[model samples]
Target: MAKLLVVGAGFAGAVHARELANAGHQVDVIDKRDHIAGNCFDYVHDCGVRIHRYGPHLFHTSNDRVVGWLSQFTGWLPYEHQVVALLDDGRKVPLPVNLDTINAVFGTRLETADDAMSYLASVALPRSPVISAEDHLYSTIGKELTDLFFRPYTKKMWQLDLSEMDAAVVRRLQIRTDRDPRYFRSDTFQALPTDGYTRAFERILDHDRISVRLTTSFSQDDMAGYDACFNSMPIDEFYEFDLGELPYRSIRFHVSHHLAATAEGLATINYTDAGPYTRETWWHALPGHRVHETSNVLRTIEEPCCYRENSLERYYPIKDRDLMYQSLYERYAARAATDDQMFFIGRCGTYQYLDMHQVINQSLVHVSKWIARS
Candidate 1:
């Protein structure tokens, strides 16, 4: 059996470790944080409600393989996420500008999908080539809607103008003309872990061949005993920013245990304009949790900020059109390519904005191939 070191005990590292251990490999997983689930970590609040420590992670994926794999660890809780946007006009409407949102925001009697389509056609401005996020949104939704809905939100999230970012960053969002208020409807599996993400991680990592070290820092010297290293740390940090540090946006969650049930009807509400924070999430609304009568509910307001090296934890990676940063990442990637035994696999490792399922899928694919070769 080969000895392997997996860094960052999140989805990528855990999945790789589990898969490797199952294949009769000795795997050691280390995390800088005290917890195992990384950003998907959740803890039961004193109030009895389970709170997602780093924002709400709603798991919904079209991949059956991913669904099947994760199902082995935890049972599913049916949860189709719904989000609302608090506009500048003090109006709350469904996000992604759906049929009800159009009626609520514009005060129009649009009943059918055809009416919604007609309205969008009337307002949406046609752009020749949509290269940036600004161009993509403006071309699809028009000037007014873009300014009200997307412009301020995008600025707050990434701290950059939409024109400065690649279109792929913005293209991930879906704009619907139907009455579907759910945030993600296209995914076939829409649910959360019945126990919580942390418990799910515990189940996955409870293998005899796997050893976990929490709050641990690793250096090049630690890689000596291991046959291979799977890194989920930031690529720039691994190289010690020899090239300029890549830009990322970090978030701070202001959590409050409410004495009463949450007033916010939806799971999350986005403050589109005139707010220090980007959005607020109510935890009680999500599936799979027992809230005792004495404990009340838990809610959080998410504030996005420019990433500080030592002060805060990096949450979201900024996808921009900066040639210098791109070139720097390419240099690191080239180094990884040269080292066949080292693998960079995850959101931070790959340095792209990815959802939970995408990360799981990548780990499964790459680790399977890696095992086959070994």
Candidate 2:
């Protein structure tokens, strides 16, 4: 048995620590935050309502292995996530610009899929090389729809121009002519944890061979006794911003409670109008909660902002194809490749926009390869 160190008790760290511990290794997991589950952490308020402390995290994945592995720790509720956009005119329509959304927004009676596709083709500009997010969206859906929905919301979320962002950032946009209003329609498994994300992580870490340390920080000097170290901290930060700081966008969540039973019908609504906040989420609408008239409903407004060091939580790594950032990440990656004891994993470590399933799958794959090599 080997002693190992896992940093950052998010999905990546928890999954890796669990797998490593099960494989006859003594693992110690550390997180800078006081809680587990990282950004997916949730807590029940005094109002008898459970709200995502960071923001709404919807788990929807197509990978059977990842689902099967996580299912052992927590049961799931059959939940297909949906999103609606509050247009500039105060009209709420289904997101992903479906047939109903088009009809409602444009005041046109497009009855069939063909009608919607034809209308889009007529309005779409000439297809250009899809490089930036702006180009990809304009080529796929056209400028009018992009301007109506994505422009303002994306600008506020990323705090950058669309042209400056990588196309991979908005590659997940599901532009459909059908009537499906679900955000993740292609996913095979779509649900929230039966309990909450924090409990799920606690279950994952509940092993005799595993020890957890919260509000603790670890560095290379702490890896002397450990056989291996799986680091989930930002790669640039780990290297002390040697090449330069990689850009990341953080959020400020304004959570409030209302006596009303329902605020927004769905879980989340993106505001297309100019506002400080990008979107608002209703917490009671999530799983493991029953709506009540007297029960206070929790609403969270997500305001995206520039990331400040040691002040706020970093959520999304800025996906600008900036030459300097790319070069810096490559330099740090090369350095990690040479360090046999240190392994970088997760969104911040790799500086990629990743969903929950992707993080788990990546950790599983990486750990499997590490075990084989060891």
Candidate 3:
């Protein structure tokens, strides 16, 4: 059996380690953080509320393979995430610009899906070839709604104007004619683990053939001992940034405790004003997170900043209309290709804004191919 090393105890590394170990390979997993689950890490607070250390992570995916695989470690709790955008006029409207949201915003008492579609079309500024996020938003919802909902949020989130960013950045969000208030509409499976995320990670990495080390950092020199390495470290850091730095946006979270039963009625609230803060999440609002005996609430507010400014804690990789960062990532990926033993996986390694299911799917595919080749 081959000895393999998996860096970063996130989904990518945990999936690889588990799969390899099941195949009779000896796997060692290491994470710089003291715990597993990466950004999905959560723990119960003193007041009995479960707090997601990073931000709120809602698991929603259409891939059956992903759902089937993760089900082995933990049972599922059905949770459809909902978000409301807090407008400047102190009005909360459903996000993704749905039928209800449109009526509420413009005081148009439209009823059917066709009515909503007609309304949007009347206001939309058609752009033949949309290249930037501003263009996409304008073409879909027009300048008024775009400025009211997206422009300021995008500015705070990416620290860049909408016109400067790629269209793909905003394309993930859907503008629905139906009054579907759920954040993720297309996903077949939208739920959280029955237990906490940390417990699920514990079960995933509990194989006899696999061992994990927490509060440990991975170095290039450590690669000499293992036959193969599945690394989730930042690709630029792995290469020591020889080709220069790739830009990433990070969040500085400020969590506060309240003696109330709930903060807002919704689980998440997006700020539409030109403030430093972007969004806030109410921990107790989520299913499987509320404690019956406790009357306290934990709210986390997010402020976006550069990864460098946030002590190198990278969350979202910045993608611009110019594609400069993508080109830089390609250079690093080319260098990674030369090392046959080293494989880069996860958001930081691939330099893409990936969801939890996408990361798991990628690791599953990669490990299967690697095992077959071996």
Candidate 4:
């Protein structure tokens, strides 16, 4: 059996560890944070409510294979999220800015769907060869809608002007013309682990062949003993930022509590305006088997802060020519190529945004490669 060292206990690292160990290989995993699940970590709140430590990870994917693999660890709970956007005038409307939402939001000239769609199409800027986030919205929906729905909310969310951000950042999440209120694009239905995200991770981290080192960091010397290393930590940190440390964005959550017989219809509501907060969620808002009582144990919270963090923990990659992560990546790419045995995985490892399923799929894919040699 091969010896594998996986740095970071997030989805990517955990997946790698599980895959290698399941095949009778020795796998050692470490995370400086002392947690099994990195960004998706969750715990019981003061009121005995299970809450996400790093905001919320509503697991949504169109990938069936990813869903099937995770089924081994946790049972699925069908949940399709509904997003509510707080307009500039303090009105709440459905997301994707659909025809119904458009009519409700504008509450004026855009009364009919045809009129709204036609207006949007007419105002859309001419297509551009190279598109930024600003250009994506302007080209697709028009400048007015982009300014209203995207510009201010984006400034509040990322702390940088949309004009400065990368086009890929806003290119993905789209506005569907249909009335599907479900926010996530999961294959059939969106699902969160029944017990909790943490419990599911515990199973993955507890494999007999997989040794876990929590609240600890991994180094080159630590990696030397292993036959191969799959690092899920930041790429820059792996290289000690030879070019420069890249900037990342993170949010701070302000939580509040109230004893209520019931909660609002939605599990989450988006406050796009400049209200010292970006989004709010009630733990028991989503109608299903909740981990806590609806009354006296619900958490209502606000997340704010729009700038890139100085620390190494990357929330969102600052994709711009200023940092030129691509250029720096080329340097990292060169180093990684030389190692031959070390493989970088995960958001920070590959320096790309990944959904929950994407991380798991990454590990599953790695298993195939790991098993091939045996």
Identify the leading candidate in terms of TM-score. Answer: 3
Model 3 steric clash pairs: none
Score every model by TM-score: 0.94, 0.94, 0.96, 0.89
- Give per-residue CA lDDT, model 4, range 1-374, as digits (tens): 88888888888988878878888899888899967799899877767667787777788887788887778788867777778887767778888677667666555445455676676677789667745788777887877667767887778766767788777878886665555566765456487788778888898778888888888887778866688888988888878887787666767766777665655656788876655577788776653335555465465565545334323346776566455776777678778878778888888888777888888887788767868876
Candidate 1: lDDT of 105? 70
lDDT of candidate model 2 versus the reference: 0.86
lDDT of each: 0.85, 0.86, 0.91, 0.75
lDDT of 2 by residue, 1-374 (tens): 98999999999999999999999999999999899998899887878778888889999999999999999999998998888998777888999789999888778999999999998877777556788889888887788788888888887886667778888878887778999989988998999898888999999999999999999987778888998899999998898887788887888889988865446567889888867788899888877754233457889998888888426467777655666666778889999999998999999989887999999999999998998788
Give each model's clash number.
0, 0, 0, 1
Worst 10 residues of 2 by lDDT: 287-296
| Model 2 lDDT, residue 348, Cα | 90
Off by over 4 Å in 4: 108-115, 122-132, 166-173, 261-263, 287-289, 298-312, 321-323
Model 3, span 157-261: residue lDDT tens: 877899887888889878889999988888999998877898999999999999999999998788787999999999999888899998889999999988764
Model 2 residue 283 distance off true place after TM-score fit, in angstroms: 0.6
Candidate 4: Cα lDDT at 234: 83
Root-mean-square deviation (CA) per prediction: 1.9, 2.0, 1.5, 2.8
Off by over 4 Å in 1: 127-132, 166-168, 309-312
Candidate 3 regions exceeding 4 Å error are 127-129
